[model samples]
Target: MSDYLEMSLEQLQKEHAELLAFNEKLDRERNGYRKYAMKYAKKVQMIESLFVVPSDDHELTIKAIKTIVERVGES
Candidate 1:
């Protein structure tokens, strides 16, 4: 009877160990998605800088800004 109870306990522990390992794999996949999202966000920020005015082109900068606003509004 003692041996039977010990075997049952060992089986339960093994199943629990498998579940913990699967959870870790899922956590890793979720972190990978978060890293990709951060990369995309950085790219968007770089692209948005095209709308900023440099010191040399006052009129052209105004026009570019207007065009950017219009395009953004259309989207």
Candidate 2:
């Protein structure tokens, strides 16, 4: 009975250590993913939310078209 009790205590200690390590790893991974998501979200807002589009004036549109054509030709 004493031997069985000792074995159980040892197994429980090992399990506790494993659980603590796993919890720390999960926390780090979650924080990394959250940081990456925030960065991606910032870029998405700039491009996808129409936040940086040019003005709708006719003169500006023409100039923009010319600039695009020039760049395309260069490419």
Candidate 3:
């Protein structure tokens, strides 16, 4: 007789296998995001290279550039 709060042996094994598979998929997705983050950082650096700040409003230009860089992923 199975206890009310206990899973059957087969069900328990199947759930364990499913959870393992899900965790593996999550790991792969995490790695992909890591790669993408690196790529995004490089792209931000490249774009920043093209930015020109006038001597008169250097601080304003810097603020604008920072905003643009932070918003790269939204577009």
Candidate 4:
């Protein structure tokens, strides 16, 4: 704190600009993680939906599994 008091206006402005840039970088990274989490959550929900109702149709189960595998592969 006392060190800041000793800084010139130019120094303070430079430091402020650097901090702002770093903050923006962190925000971008946070947003990326948030998007990834949402995508993963949707995939998990899809998997859960498949099991929610017990289905005796083997063909339907196979199709669902194939769809899931394709989606996973795409990711």
Candidate 5:
């Protein structure tokens, strides 16, 4: 913050522009992940619906699906 205060107008302007560009890039990436999460959630819901019977196997399957999705997102 002190560095910015000492910077000339042109330097500050350039720094501001660079920061804005980086922020936009982050926003784009965040939006992409949000879309992916929504799609994956919908798919999980569909799979859950397919298993009408409530049993240990069904619970395990759902847990497995959630874990896989989480791992994939991390990658």
Candidate 6:
């Protein structure tokens, strides 16, 4: 192989490896975000189930608001 061709091949291989590493890092971040989203969804679902009332009462609405405020404050 010519000297120039060998050098070019090495550079390409290095770039390929860097791209692969970057892609893996992105995959890890995406997975983490997915897990966090699922957790947040579950928390919201729980809160809704706990506070949702059958009647449209102002006091009940205020209580729900307070509950949410307390929950957020704890977090």
Best by TM-score: 4
TM-score of 6: 0.59
- The global C-alpha lDDT for each of the candidates, from Candidate 1 onward, is 0.68, 0.65, 0.75, 0.83, 0.78, 0.71
What would the TM-scores of all predictions be?
A: 0.53, 0.55, 0.53, 0.77, 0.66, 0.59
Tens digits of per-residue lDDT for model 3, 20-74: 9999999999998998897688767756665643357778767767776777665
lDDT of 5 by residue, 1-75 (tens): 558778999998999999999999999999999988887886677567656766677678778677766664454
Error of 6 at 21 (Å): 0.1
Cα error of candidate 5 at position 13, Å: 0.4
Model 6: per-residue Cα lDDT at residue 63: 81
Q: Which residue pairs in model 6 clash with each other?
A: none
State model 6's lDDT.
0.71
Residues 1-75 of candidate 1: C-alpha lDDT, one tens digit per residue: 234456677787887798899999999999989887776665556446865644586686667656654454232
Predicted structure 4: clash tally: 0
Itemize residue pairs with steric clashes in candidate 4: none
On residues 1-75, what C-alpha lDDT tens digit does candidate 4 reach at each position? 439989999999999999999999999999999988887777677878898888999798888877875685346
TM-score of 4: 0.77
Clashes of each: 0, 0, 0, 0, 0, 0
Writing each residue's lDDT as its tens digit, candidate 6 over 7-72 gives 677787887798899999999999989987876676577567765556568687668756764574
Mark the regions of model 1 whose C-alpha exceeds 4 Å error after superposition: 1-7, 52-75
Worst 10 residues of 6 by lDDT: 66-75
For lDDT, candidate 4 versus 5, the one ahead is 4
TM-score between candidate 5 and the true structure = 0.66
After the best TM-score superposition of candidate 6, give how far the Cα of residue 38 lies from its true spot, in angstroms: 0.6
Which candidate gets the maximum lDDT versus the true structure?
4
